[model samples]
Target: MNSLSAPQPVPLAQAHRLLNHGPTVLVSSAHGKRRNIMAASWSMPLDFDPPKVAVVLDKATLTRELVDASGEFVLAVPCRAIAEQTLAAGSLSGRDGDKFAALEFETFPASRVAAPLPAGCIAWLECRVIDEPQVQHTYDLFLGEVLAAWADPAEFSDGRWHFSAEGRRSIHYVAGGQFFSTGEAFEVSVTG
Candidate 1:
């Protein structure tokens, strides 16, 4: 709906924390005059230093094709607030038309990549693909170096999520169109 407020920049060292807990992400890519977004549940942080991330993109999907051509992408973590839209994105194919308008998603430019950042997502990671053609061909998995990262201030700051805003908590996907929001925070210590 509304564009994200001035998102706060997350330090490169802490960017891995964004996806550490496992949330479904909106994978956006742009090449030439076309851009597209798709929902993906199979993405994760692969490294800490230099901030690497791994995500699966289907060979048949336009988003994957775009990423292949552009060598860049943006993984925007959506929340319960836009669950319906996220599901719509996953269900729809991008070859027909503009998915952003079809899904009613608002987006803004990314500084280091052509991929636009979807609005309302709790966090955004702009990435450059690391050349890994063998794995990409065999498994459709992509490895990326996180170039820039951002988070919604009210929800995430100082490399941690403090979910105080409504419907802004990160979400996880279940099978058959079901999803779950992140639960309450808990902490534990060991002294043995």
Candidate 2:
């Protein structure tokens, strides 16, 4: 799929909605000639309006090294269609070889970051790291300011998600190779 046409721009203020549901994300990073992709379930929106996000990256991972050197990364929300690849990404180490090619994944360049956004994802967030050395060193946490965000028009638009098709819905990772696809949507009124 063509990444440019597949994803429509999501306003900075509404970008957090893309990650608010807390699905597993593929964090992509590149510094100099080395580039890598990894699956991460410990990622979430930390703020809105000049949106910010936090994700846990182990200190020893190549992703951590790249993000530390480049100060940028792309968080792509993968759907059920790529579940196997997603699992493999997190399972293998980029130190072994190019994970993307090894997993037979495709990608396109991101607008605001050097890391390429993996194709077939439901949404993408290009971010620049917000330095916090203490927390970074102690907790292996990285915080970023969202520079750009995009979503698949078929699954998301107007700050909402419509997962009507099979294998097209966002997924949440459990342990091992298991995952749960986002289910039905509903609403309730609360009068304050």
Q: Which candidate gets the maximum lDDT versus the true structure?
A: 1
* Position 141, candidate 2: lDDT: 95
Q: Candidate 2 residues 118-185, lDDT tens each?
A: 99898999999999999999999999999999999888888999875878889999896899999989
Query: How well does each candidate superpose onto the true structure, as a TM-score?
Result: 0.97, 0.96
RMSD of 1: 1.1
Per-residue lDDT of 19 in model 1: 96
RMSD of each: 1.1, 1.4
Q: How accurate is candidate 2 locally (lDDT)?
A: 0.92
State each model's CA lDDT, in order: 0.93, 0.92
Model 1 TM-score relative to the real fold: 0.97
Q: Give the C-alpha miss distance for residue 176 in model 2, angstroms.
A: 1.7
